[model samples]
Target: MAYYIGTNGLAAFSVINYLHAFMFLAFLGIGSTIQPMISYYYGARKPEMIKSTIRISELTVLSLGALFILIGFFGADFLVSIFGVASDTIADMAATGIHLFFLGYVFMGINFIYMTYYQSIGYIKPSVGITVFRGFILLILMLLILPYFFGINGIWLSLPVAESIVAVVLMVYARKGVMEQGTFERRF
Candidate 1:
Protein backbone atom coordinates (compact mmCIF):
# COMPACT_ATOMS: atom_id res chain seq x y z
CA MET A 1 0.00 0.00 0.00
CA ALA A 2 2.81 2.35 0.83
CA TYR A 3 4.36 1.52 -2.47
CA TYR A 4 1.05 2.02 -4.25
CA ILE A 5 0.58 5.43 -2.67
CA GLY A 6 4.10 6.39 -3.70
CA THR A 7 5.31 6.92 -0.16
CA ASN A 8 7.91 4.15 -0.33
CA GLY A 9 10.27 3.27 -3.13
CA LEU A 10 10.58 -0.28 -4.41
CA ALA A 11 13.93 -1.05 -2.77
CA ALA A 12 12.94 0.46 0.56
CA PHE A 13 9.63 -1.30 0.44
CA SER A 14 11.29 -4.62 -0.22
CA VAL A 15 13.66 -4.18 2.69
CA ILE A 16 10.87 -3.22 5.03
CA ASN A 17 8.83 -6.18 3.87
CA TYR A 18 11.78 -8.46 4.58
CA LEU A 19 12.10 -7.01 8.06
CA HIS A 20 8.41 -7.56 8.70
CA ALA A 21 8.72 -11.18 7.58
CA PHE A 22 11.68 -11.70 9.89
CA MET A 23 9.75 -10.24 12.80
CA PHE A 24 6.82 -12.50 12.03
CA LEU A 25 9.08 -15.55 12.15
CA ALA A 26 10.60 -14.39 15.41
CA PHE A 27 7.14 -14.05 16.94
CA LEU A 28 6.17 -17.51 15.68
CA GLY A 29 9.30 -19.01 17.20
CA ILE A 30 8.55 -17.47 20.57
CA GLY A 31 4.91 -18.54 20.42
CA SER A 32 5.86 -22.11 19.43
CA THR A 33 7.98 -22.41 22.55
CA ILE A 34 4.95 -21.86 24.79
CA GLN A 35 2.02 -23.25 22.77
CA PRO A 36 3.01 -26.93 23.10
CA MET A 37 3.57 -26.52 26.79
CA ILE A 38 -0.05 -25.48 27.20
CA SER A 39 -1.61 -27.69 24.50
CA TYR A 40 -0.01 -31.01 25.50
CA TYR A 41 -0.43 -30.36 29.18
CA TYR A 42 -4.08 -29.51 28.70
CA GLY A 43 -4.65 -32.44 26.37
CA ALA A 44 -3.25 -34.77 29.01
CA ARG A 45 -5.90 -33.60 31.50
CA LYS A 46 -3.66 -31.30 33.48
CA PRO A 47 -6.20 -28.53 33.86
CA GLU A 48 -4.35 -26.69 36.59
CA MET A 49 -1.15 -26.78 34.58
CA ILE A 50 -2.99 -25.41 31.58
CA LYS A 51 -4.29 -22.51 33.63
CA SER A 52 -0.80 -21.66 34.83
CA THR A 53 0.54 -21.93 31.31
CA ILE A 54 -2.17 -19.55 30.12
CA ARG A 55 -1.14 -17.01 32.73
CA ILE A 56 2.44 -17.26 31.52
CA SER A 57 1.38 -16.83 27.90
CA GLU A 58 -0.75 -13.84 28.83
CA LEU A 59 2.07 -12.13 30.66
CA THR A 60 4.60 -12.86 27.94
CA VAL A 61 2.29 -11.62 25.23
CA LEU A 62 1.34 -8.52 27.18
CA SER A 63 4.95 -7.61 27.85
CA LEU A 64 6.01 -8.21 24.28
CA GLY A 65 2.99 -6.39 22.86
CA ALA A 66 3.56 -3.38 25.07
CA LEU A 67 7.22 -3.21 24.19
CA PHE A 68 6.46 -3.59 20.50
CA ILE A 69 3.80 -0.89 20.51
CA LEU A 70 6.07 1.48 22.37
CA ILE A 71 8.91 0.95 19.97
CA GLY A 72 6.64 1.15 16.96
CA PHE A 73 5.12 4.39 18.18
CA PHE A 74 8.25 6.14 19.38
CA GLY A 75 10.97 4.67 17.21
CA ALA A 76 9.25 4.19 13.89
CA ASP A 77 11.74 6.43 12.21
CA PHE A 78 14.67 4.48 13.59
CA LEU A 79 13.28 1.34 11.98
CA VAL A 80 12.50 2.96 8.62
CA SER A 81 15.93 4.47 8.71
CA ILE A 82 17.34 0.99 8.69
CA PHE A 83 15.51 0.42 5.40
CA GLY A 84 16.95 3.70 4.09
CA VAL A 85 13.61 5.46 3.76
CA ALA A 86 14.78 8.97 2.91
CA SER A 87 11.53 10.78 2.19
CA ASP A 88 10.13 12.54 5.24
CA THR A 89 6.59 11.86 4.10
CA ILE A 90 7.37 8.20 3.67
CA ALA A 91 9.02 8.08 7.06
CA ASP A 92 5.94 9.62 8.64
CA MET A 93 3.69 7.13 6.90
CA ALA A 94 5.87 4.26 8.07
CA ALA A 95 5.74 5.59 11.62
CA THR A 96 1.97 5.88 11.45
CA GLY A 97 1.76 2.34 10.15
CA ILE A 98 3.96 1.04 12.96
CA HIS A 99 1.78 2.56 15.66
CA LEU A 100 -1.48 1.44 14.09
CA PHE A 101 -0.23 -2.05 13.37
CA PHE A 102 0.28 -2.80 17.08
CA LEU A 103 -3.45 -2.63 17.73
CA GLY A 104 -3.81 -5.91 15.83
CA TYR A 105 -1.31 -7.60 18.13
CA VAL A 106 -3.37 -6.76 21.18
CA PHE A 107 -6.43 -8.47 19.71
CA MET A 108 -4.27 -11.23 18.24
CA GLY A 109 -3.22 -12.46 21.67
CA ILE A 110 -6.84 -13.26 22.51
CA ASN A 111 -7.54 -14.88 19.16
CA PHE A 112 -4.35 -16.94 19.35
CA ILE A 113 -5.10 -18.34 22.82
CA TYR A 114 -8.60 -19.30 21.79
CA MET A 115 -7.38 -20.87 18.56
CA THR A 116 -4.73 -22.79 20.44
CA TYR A 117 -7.35 -24.06 22.87
CA TYR A 118 -9.44 -25.32 19.96
CA GLN A 119 -6.37 -26.91 18.41
CA SER A 120 -5.39 -28.57 21.69
CA ILE A 121 -8.76 -30.31 21.74
CA GLY A 122 -8.17 -31.75 18.26
CA TYR A 123 -10.74 -29.43 16.70
CA ILE A 124 -8.29 -28.83 13.93
CA LYS A 125 -10.91 -27.90 11.35
CA PRO A 126 -12.36 -25.04 13.36
CA SER A 127 -8.88 -23.92 14.32
CA VAL A 128 -7.81 -23.87 10.69
CA GLY A 129 -11.02 -22.14 9.73
CA ILE A 130 -10.36 -19.42 12.25
CA THR A 131 -6.82 -19.01 10.95
CA VAL A 132 -8.02 -18.75 7.39
CA PHE A 133 -10.50 -16.07 8.34
CA ARG A 134 -8.06 -14.23 10.52
CA GLY A 135 -5.10 -14.48 8.15
CA PHE A 136 -5.86 -14.64 4.44
CA ILE A 137 -9.38 -13.29 4.45
CA LEU A 138 -8.31 -10.29 6.45
CA LEU A 139 -5.32 -9.70 4.19
CA ILE A 140 -7.48 -9.89 1.10
CA LEU A 141 -9.96 -7.48 2.60
CA MET A 142 -7.25 -4.99 3.44
CA LEU A 143 -5.83 -5.26 -0.04
CA LEU A 144 -9.23 -4.59 -1.51
CA ILE A 145 -10.70 -2.03 0.89
CA LEU A 146 -7.98 0.06 2.50
CA PRO A 147 -6.61 1.65 -0.60
CA TYR A 148 -9.94 3.25 -1.40
CA PHE A 149 -10.48 4.86 1.99
CA PHE A 150 -7.38 5.63 4.01
CA GLY A 151 -4.78 4.88 1.42
CA ILE A 152 -1.71 3.71 3.35
CA ASN A 153 -3.25 4.34 6.75
CA GLY A 154 -6.27 2.30 5.79
CA ILE A 155 -4.03 -0.63 5.15
CA TRP A 156 -2.56 -0.25 8.60
CA LEU A 157 -5.96 0.10 10.26
CA SER A 158 -7.55 -2.85 8.46
CA LEU A 159 -5.59 -5.37 10.52
CA PRO A 160 -6.92 -4.45 13.96
CA VAL A 161 -10.46 -4.13 12.64
CA ALA A 162 -10.29 -7.61 11.14
CA GLU A 163 -8.67 -9.10 14.23
CA SER A 164 -11.22 -7.49 16.50
CA ILE A 165 -14.00 -9.05 14.47
CA VAL A 166 -12.34 -12.47 14.48
CA ALA A 167 -11.82 -12.36 18.23
CA VAL A 168 -15.47 -11.54 18.78
CA VAL A 169 -16.53 -14.37 16.52
CA LEU A 170 -14.26 -16.80 18.33
CA MET A 171 -15.59 -15.65 21.67
CA VAL A 172 -19.14 -16.15 20.50
CA TYR A 173 -18.27 -19.62 19.28
CA ALA A 174 -16.64 -20.36 22.62
CA ARG A 175 -19.87 -19.58 24.45
CA LYS A 176 -21.61 -22.51 22.75
CA GLY A 177 -19.73 -24.84 25.09
CA VAL A 178 -20.84 -23.00 28.22
CA MET A 179 -23.71 -25.43 28.89
CA GLU A 180 -21.57 -28.52 28.42
CA GLN A 181 -19.08 -30.43 30.56
CA GLY A 182 -15.30 -30.81 30.51
CA THR A 183 -12.84 -28.81 28.39
CA PHE A 184 -12.17 -30.43 25.03
CA GLU A 185 -15.13 -32.76 25.07
CA ARG A 186 -17.71 -30.04 25.55
CA ARG A 187 -20.43 -30.26 22.89
CA PHE A 188 -21.98 -27.29 21.21
Candidate 2:
Protein backbone atom coordinates (compact mmCIF):
# COMPACT_ATOMS: atom_id res chain seq x y z
CA MET A 1 0.00 0.00 0.00
CA ALA A 2 1.17 3.58 -0.66
CA TYR A 3 2.37 5.28 2.50
CA TYR A 4 0.60 8.51 1.67
CA ILE A 5 -2.72 6.97 2.54
CA GLY A 6 -1.62 6.69 6.16
CA THR A 7 -0.28 10.18 6.64
CA ASN A 8 -2.27 13.02 8.20
CA GLY A 9 -4.09 15.30 5.78
CA LEU A 10 -2.10 18.22 7.20
CA ALA A 11 0.96 16.91 5.42
CA ALA A 12 -0.74 17.22 2.09
CA PHE A 13 -1.90 20.70 2.91
CA SER A 14 1.61 21.62 3.94
CA VAL A 15 3.01 20.36 0.69
CA ILE A 16 0.43 22.29 -1.30
CA ASN A 17 1.10 25.39 0.76
CA TYR A 18 4.80 25.06 0.15
CA LEU A 19 4.22 24.84 -3.56
CA HIS A 20 2.13 28.00 -3.42
CA ALA A 21 4.83 29.80 -1.48
CA PHE A 22 7.40 28.74 -4.05
CA MET A 23 5.25 30.06 -6.85
CA PHE A 24 4.78 33.35 -5.03
CA LEU A 25 8.51 33.63 -4.55
CA ALA A 26 9.07 33.08 -8.24
CA PHE A 27 7.18 36.30 -8.99
CA LEU A 28 8.85 38.26 -6.19
CA GLY A 29 12.02 38.96 -8.14
CA ILE A 30 10.25 40.95 -10.81
CA GLY A 31 8.03 42.62 -8.24
CA SER A 32 11.01 43.54 -6.10
CA THR A 33 12.70 45.23 -9.03
CA ILE A 34 9.67 47.31 -9.96
CA GLN A 35 8.34 48.08 -6.48
CA PRO A 36 11.24 50.16 -5.17
CA MET A 37 11.33 52.34 -8.24
CA ILE A 38 7.60 52.96 -7.93
CA SER A 39 8.10 54.06 -4.33
CA TYR A 40 11.09 56.23 -5.11
CA TYR A 41 9.24 58.18 -7.78
CA TYR A 42 6.10 58.49 -5.70
CA GLY A 43 7.99 59.70 -2.65
CA ALA A 44 9.78 62.33 -4.66
CA ARG A 45 6.35 63.65 -5.71
CA LYS A 46 7.44 63.47 -9.30
CA PRO A 47 4.13 62.93 -10.98
CA GLU A 48 5.71 62.49 -14.36
CA MET A 49 8.17 59.88 -13.15
CA ILE A 50 5.44 58.02 -11.28
CA LYS A 51 3.23 58.04 -14.37
CA SER A 52 6.02 56.79 -16.58
CA THR A 53 6.92 53.94 -14.26
CA ILE A 54 3.33 52.84 -13.93
CA ARG A 55 2.82 52.97 -17.69
CA ILE A 56 5.98 51.00 -18.41
CA SER A 57 5.29 48.40 -15.73
CA GLU A 58 1.74 47.91 -16.94
CA LEU A 59 2.87 47.43 -20.53
CA THR A 60 5.61 45.05 -19.54
CA VAL A 61 3.38 42.93 -17.38
CA LEU A 62 0.65 43.02 -20.01
CA SER A 63 3.02 41.78 -22.66
CA LEU A 64 4.16 38.96 -20.41
CA GLY A 65 0.57 38.01 -19.64
CA ALA A 66 -0.37 38.16 -23.30
CA LEU A 67 2.54 35.95 -24.26
CA PHE A 68 1.58 33.35 -21.66
CA ILE A 69 -2.07 33.48 -22.65
CA LEU A 70 -1.13 32.99 -26.28
CA ILE A 71 0.96 30.00 -25.40
CA GLY A 72 -1.81 28.52 -23.28
CA PHE A 73 -4.33 29.09 -26.07
CA PHE A 74 -2.59 28.35 -29.34
CA GLY A 75 0.41 26.36 -28.21
CA ALA A 76 -1.48 24.25 -25.72
CA ASP A 77 -2.07 21.49 -28.18
CA PHE A 78 1.49 21.34 -29.37
CA LEU A 79 2.97 21.42 -25.86
CA VAL A 80 0.63 18.74 -24.57
CA SER A 81 1.52 16.55 -27.53
CA ILE A 82 5.02 16.15 -26.08
CA PHE A 83 3.96 14.56 -22.79
CA GLY A 84 2.78 11.30 -24.38
CA VAL A 85 -0.34 11.34 -22.27
CA ALA A 86 -2.07 9.40 -25.06
CA SER A 87 -5.45 10.71 -23.93
CA ASP A 88 -7.15 13.52 -25.76
CA THR A 89 -9.40 14.32 -22.81
CA ILE A 90 -6.48 14.67 -20.43
CA ALA A 91 -4.63 16.97 -22.79
CA ASP A 92 -7.68 19.10 -23.32
CA MET A 93 -8.32 19.42 -19.60
CA ALA A 94 -4.71 20.38 -18.96
CA ALA A 95 -4.87 23.01 -21.65
CA THR A 96 -8.11 24.35 -20.22
CA GLY A 97 -6.54 24.64 -16.78
CA ILE A 98 -3.61 26.55 -18.22
CA HIS A 99 -5.93 28.91 -20.03
CA LEU A 100 -8.05 29.49 -16.95
CA PHE A 101 -5.05 30.32 -14.78
CA PHE A 102 -3.73 32.99 -17.13
CA LEU A 103 -7.10 34.57 -17.86
CA GLY A 104 -6.82 36.86 -14.80
CA TYR A 105 -3.34 38.22 -15.44
CA VAL A 106 -4.68 41.42 -16.92
CA PHE A 107 -6.56 42.22 -13.74
CA MET A 108 -3.49 41.16 -11.80
CA GLY A 109 -1.53 43.92 -13.49
CA ILE A 110 -3.94 46.53 -12.18
CA ASN A 111 -3.84 44.95 -8.75
CA PHE A 112 -0.07 45.30 -8.74
CA ILE A 113 -0.41 49.03 -9.11
CA TYR A 114 -2.63 49.40 -6.06
CA MET A 115 -0.47 47.17 -3.93
CA THR A 116 2.59 49.13 -4.98
CA TYR A 117 0.84 52.42 -4.25
CA TYR A 118 0.91 51.74 -0.53
CA GLN A 119 4.51 50.67 -0.77
CA SER A 120 5.36 53.89 -2.54
CA ILE A 121 4.06 55.90 0.38
CA GLY A 122 6.33 54.05 2.82
CA TYR A 123 3.26 52.34 4.20
CA ILE A 124 4.25 48.71 3.89
CA LYS A 125 1.78 47.23 6.35
CA PRO A 126 -1.24 47.66 4.10
CA SER A 127 0.55 46.26 1.11
CA VAL A 128 1.78 43.31 3.12
CA GLY A 129 -1.70 42.74 4.48
CA ILE A 130 -3.15 42.64 1.00
CA THR A 131 -0.53 40.21 -0.22
CA VAL A 132 -1.04 37.88 2.71
CA PHE A 133 -4.78 38.02 2.43
CA ARG A 134 -4.63 37.32 -1.26
CA GLY A 135 -2.20 34.45 -0.93
CA PHE A 136 -3.78 32.78 2.09
CA ILE A 137 -7.25 33.89 3.10
CA LEU A 138 -8.46 34.49 -0.42
CA LEU A 139 -7.22 31.07 -1.40
CA ILE A 140 -9.04 29.47 1.49
CA LEU A 141 -12.22 31.28 0.55
CA MET A 142 -11.85 30.08 -3.00
CA LEU A 143 -11.33 26.54 -1.83
CA LEU A 144 -14.63 26.79 0.00
CA ILE A 145 -16.49 28.56 -2.77
CA LEU A 146 -15.13 26.77 -5.82
CA PRO A 147 -15.98 23.29 -4.64
CA TYR A 148 -19.60 24.04 -3.81
CA PHE A 149 -20.47 25.22 -7.27
CA PHE A 150 -18.23 24.85 -10.34
CA GLY A 151 -15.71 22.51 -8.77
CA ILE A 152 -12.10 22.86 -9.89
CA ASN A 153 -12.93 25.47 -12.46
CA GLY A 154 -14.06 27.74 -9.63
CA ILE A 155 -10.73 27.27 -7.93
CA TRP A 156 -8.97 28.13 -11.15
CA LEU A 157 -10.89 31.39 -11.44
CA SER A 158 -10.58 32.34 -7.79
CA LEU A 159 -7.16 33.94 -7.94
CA PRO A 160 -7.95 36.49 -10.62
CA VAL A 161 -11.30 37.31 -9.11
CA ALA A 162 -9.88 37.77 -5.63
CA GLU A 163 -7.02 39.86 -6.97
CA SER A 164 -9.43 42.13 -8.80
CA ILE A 165 -11.37 42.67 -5.59
CA VAL A 166 -8.24 43.54 -3.65
CA ALA A 167 -7.23 45.95 -6.37
CA VAL A 168 -10.56 47.74 -6.15
CA VAL A 169 -10.31 48.13 -2.42
CA LEU A 170 -6.75 49.40 -2.58
CA MET A 171 -7.68 51.89 -5.25
CA VAL A 172 -10.52 53.20 -3.13
CA TYR A 173 -8.28 53.66 -0.15
CA ALA A 174 -5.67 55.38 -2.25
CA ARG A 175 -8.23 57.69 -3.78
CA LYS A 176 -9.48 58.63 -0.35
CA GLY A 177 -5.97 59.46 0.75
CA VAL A 178 -5.52 61.77 -2.17
CA MET A 179 -8.87 63.40 -1.53
CA GLU A 180 -8.00 63.93 2.12
CA GLN A 181 -5.18 66.24 1.03
CA GLY A 182 -2.20 64.79 2.80
CA THR A 183 1.27 65.37 1.47
CA PHE A 184 4.37 63.19 1.70
CA GLU A 185 7.79 64.80 1.85
CA ARG A 186 10.50 63.42 -0.36
CA ARG A 187 12.97 61.22 1.52
CA PHE A 188 15.81 62.50 -0.57
TM-score of 1: 0.78
> In candidate 1, which residue ranges exceed 4 Å CA deviation?
2-4, 7-16, 171-182, 186-188
Error of 2 at 138 (Å): 1.7
Off by over 4 Å in 2: 1-29, 81-89, 171-188
RMSD of each candidate?
A: 3.3, 6.3
lDDT of 1 by residue, 74-151 (tens): 887788888777678667766677778766766676566656766765677777777888888986787678868776
Q: Local error of candidate 2 at 182, Å? A: 9.7
**Tens-digit lDDT track of model 2 for 53-134:** 6667667666765665676568766655655545555556555555665565655655565567667767787777887877
Clash pairs, model 2 backbone:
none
